[model samples]
Target chain A: MSDPAPQVPPQLAAYRATIDNLDAALIHLLAERFRCTRQVGRLKADLHLPPSDPAREEQQVARLRALAEEAGLDPVFAEKFFTFIVAEVIRHHEAIRDELSE
Target chain B: MSDPAPQVPPQLAAYRATIDNLDAALIHLLAERFRCTRQVGRLKADLHLPPSDPAREEQQVARLRALAEEAGLDPVFAEKFFTFIVAEVIRHHEAIRDELSE
Candidate 1:
């Protein structure tokens, strides 16, 4: 990666360094989240559980949207992000279920 | 939201429920993440810090990609995810810096 411009304002560069640091934290958090969910997936597979719960998903989306608005973030964007994460989770659970059934 | 099929395999339905629950947990975790990051942005604004750090960004990308691979996820996808999150964080930081400057 190219170095941040040497002559650019130091403050701007510092801000970016902090942002990058936080982004790394986020990735680690996400990995931890997926690991926990993977365990849940395995449990469900053992019990022969379905891979999606429409009602619960709806409730969560509504709840998170409200929280997002309260936080001054765009509710719609938060909803979209949640949806994407949930979809990925469902996909993983489905794979686990298939593996267990076979 | 439509109910999961009544006649569908109970196991599949159970799996979906678990997945939904896990997804909800993930949303809460992400919300918490953003909250902490927002505080960092505010601090940067107060100090007049820059909003992008190329070297640090590169380091974080490499770190996250490795973590993703170790977690059985795609490194490339993790990189993209980090890139997206960093961009968003930078945007927020820039806005905060502008507000303070003005």
Candidate 2:
């Protein structure tokens, strides 16, 4: 059982249209980010380097926290979000390393 | 005790620069998204509409999942990311509604 949607006012619709476009843009940006990270993973594997770089990750966290504060967003949330993405990237990097070893 | 930073090869340095730019862009986009959502919260409060809309969220989940697949990203990860942002937006909306009621 689902309730029917209420009549969306025009202003709300316009805002949503903009939001949708921004969401699409965000996804594309993320895709590009992962693409770059994947290349890094391959390079690291070829070089016999570790999959994760803690120093670089720490630097990124600090840089992004500052950027988040500048953008009027919560630094903690930004850090959490970045951590989430980094975890995924590391997983991919580890997988790449394992594939190279096999 | 921390590992020393590696001498980054030029190719890796280039990739990191691109990743940093994309991360900054992502943060700005999210800031804009939250800005728009906050306005939506205020308007919903004015209209006495509910803070959370499950039906719309479900629709959005489906839409973004499809978009993620099209972008060659993991749909599950995309859904999880969207769900994370939506949770924050709902919390903001609830706060707005409470403020209006007071």
Candidate 3:
């Protein structure tokens, strides 16, 4: 169950609004990323290539971890986040490969 | 434990690199959002105000779910994402409030 929402004063509403805006931007950004990655998945399927790439994944995780630290975010968390995303991308690629084969 | 990384072909390496770039952009955007939200927390503490706002939270969630739909993302997923972030933001606000008082 979710925690009870707080009772924010009128003056504080603007901050939450800003956060909402930011969240919207995040959604859009993620959509764009997926859109590009989807193309990669299709290309991989077209070439009869495998979905996963451990070396490239490792490189990306390391790069993102460093970048996260530079940006003052937890490297471990950033890596975990990317790991989750990479899994999803591969899943999509696998599905695309199957679809193209059939 | 994380799953073993895939062995991506050379052709796919470029795609992974693009994903990495997009992820970095996401991190930067998140950092910026938190920075703004932090200011709001401080202001709230200064005024001895509470952190959460149920009404605004609901409005934002509804707005985002719609935005997510327009962007081709899952509405339920978007709401959940905001709920998670809101929890974190409230936690931070609570901390700031305590620190200012102490």
Q: Is candidate 1 or candidate 2 better by TM-score?
A: 2
> For candidate 2, lDDT tens digit of each residue in B9-77?
898899999999999999999889988999999999998888888988888889888988999888898
Candidate structures ordered by DockQ, highest first: 2, 3, 1
- Please give the lDDT score for candidate 2: 0.91
- Clashing residue pairs found in predicted model 2: none
Model 2 C-alpha lDDT per residue in residues A53-74, reported as the tens digit of each score: 8888999999999999999888
Tens digit of lDDT per residue, candidate 3, span B1-102?
Answer: 776865556766786677767888988777777788789989978887678768767888899899989998767767866776677679888999989889
Candidate 1, A2-83: lDDT as tens digits = 8765554565456446555555555665676677677768876776667776876787789778877766666776787777
How are the candidates ranked when ordered by lDDT, highest leading? 2, 3, 1
Candidate 2: stretches off by over 4 Å: A1-5, B1-5
Please report, as a residue range, the 10-residue window in candidate 1 chain B with the lowest summed lDDT.
B18-27
Candidate 1 regions off by >4 Å?
A1-6, B1-60, B67-74, B86-102
* Residue A75 lDDT, candidate 1, scale 0-100: 77
Better of 1 and 3 by TM-score: 3
**In terms of TM-score, which candidate is stronger, 2 or 3?**
2
Give the number of the best model, judged by DockQ: 2
